[model samples]
Target: MTETRKTVWGVLSTANIAVNQVIPALQKSERLVVGAIASRDEDRATAVARRLGIARAYGDYDALLDDPEIDIVYNPLPNHLHVPWTLRALEAGKHVLCEKPLALSAAEATTLIETSKRTGKNVREAFMIRDHPQWLRARELVQGGALGEVRAIHVSFCYDNRDPANVRNQLDIGGGALFDIGCYAVAVGRFIFACEPERVVAEVDRDPDFGTDRLTSAIMVFPGGRRLVFTCATQLVRSQDVQIIGTTGRVSIAVPFNQSPDREARLLMDDGTVLKGGDPAVETFGPVDQYLLQAEAFSELCVSGSVDPYGLQDAVRNMSVIDALWSSEETRGWADVRQD
Candidate 1:
């Protein structure tokens, strides 16, 4: 007998992330089918559906969620909308894979977690960096004691988002350097250290015109006294790097964070040995394919009645750190993460 296909998926927005990544990924995944595409504008939704060859297009997000054929909902909406739509999808009995910074605040993320439990649905935050092979290998090295007692970590993810009208510069929509790029730094820090930070201290620079943060630098101290110094900027040139320093040696990965699953990445050790990895020729179909992998993982969990590595609970903890960092900036001191 032939095995049945795994899932029927929907796109929650016509955002670039979906247009470029998710749609193509769904087309590529053998286990999934693109059921529909949704946008606030009818024409845009129709156009995207045609371009992606999706069966249906809905002008309203709720319509897509209400569709019985859509088993998975890929939400790439603005940051502030993540929580609401995710909760709506869960309540509608659709598995949700939402983009990063899962929700604008920790409270919102907590609500998502609780709702998922009560509703018995799967909800995950799209942190593709963790899903890539290189990142997985790095984590294994750190966790396996190959690095021998990690001492400090330094990470940076900065890029120029010069579009004044772009949502990344909008505060009300939950746009800022911290929400956009700083999230990756925080994720890498947590993964390298294998735990949440015990304390967070940060400083943020607000754009005079946009009124949103243009830059943020934060220092997180982890349980084993490991320090992670990181920075993110929306007004600077593109750069991504991560370094893990230990007592015996150290490891560094160039372009350590991003959507590129197949880019050339290097691991440098203290002994002057450089282990090369990642494929420079492998082009990223964009964040969507990563989202598909994420979707597949979530579906496996749903099928086996297991929990994902990065579930709604993990999203809440990550957001708690984000909230604490912002609060630390306001208080001008280190702030402890408040868990629910």
Candidate 2:
């Protein structure tokens, strides 16, 4: 599509993830410009806007969403609030690219899909890792059937933080390991399989003090006898990796999820590494930020009005699997996923 002008983005929150990560990356995209920033506190909004060199600051989220000039809304709110704010933004005549796990449940995700349809605006889940070059290569490797039929996939992401004031620790505000880092694990399995899981068996360790899950592990069985085992944690040493085993061979990704473009990503193969006694086959990505790539992609979709290949439907599907996982934790057995 032809670009007439850059897409103007207005952020819905002063969340640290926005201030530190997404907004900075969005600014780097030539196709994107930070139009405004908002917070519930006027002074806080002004301070963040000045610090980030944003054009406008609003004391409330409604002001940013109501800006007629803002072409896109970048929402980085807490998990439970994602759908509500995204609906508000779409109703205000703006496209949306909300943060991951777009909604708390499959029901909420379906609601988001219908709302976006009614509003005639495109809304997407902000899974930046999907657009990264390294991940693209991994997808090609897996979907290409390098090792024949995929038998199992193992993915893990972890971090250690005990901040009491952080929203991640607040159960009432959608605080939990599964909703936070575990979303990445679930997304990875879904992406690699190129299909949804059929059933899930999960177990979670909830924090007694915070009343939120602190660690979670799940096994999802997809069609054709494929299984995915994943684990995520909030109180563990920082770590991330994904390994896929197939009937023919195996694929390993050293830096699978939370990655920096500046770093080198290794896609290891058993045949090349074990017998050859050589280093893992490596693919280095551009210093290009994944967030910038996602932003530019969203801008293209906004300008072209093309169908988003993995927007609401994918969000809803992923959330449905998540719902099964959560349910499995309670049932202490397999919970079936609803493909219908």
- TM-score winner: 2
Q: Rate the local accuracy (lDDT) of all candidates.
A: 0.80, 0.86
Can you write out model 2's per-residue Cα lDDT over 1-340, one digit (the tens) per residue?
2377888999988998899889999888878799999999989999999999998999999988888789999999998899999999989989999998798889988887677888889989999999887788878877898778778999898888789788889998888889998888888888888888899999999988998889999998988888989899888999998888888878888777666756665677774456676665555555668888899898898899899987899898889998998899889999999896
| Per-residue alpha-carbon lDDT of candidate 1 for residues 209-327, written as tens digits (9 for 90 to 100) | 88888889999988878899998999989988788877766777756665453445456555334335432222122323455566666666666667677887788888889999989
TM-scores across all candidates? 0.91, 0.96
Q: How far off is residue 233 in model 1, in Å?
A: 0.4
Off by over 4 Å in 2: 272-278
Q: After superposition, how far is residue 323 of candidate 1 from its true place, in Å?
A: 1.2
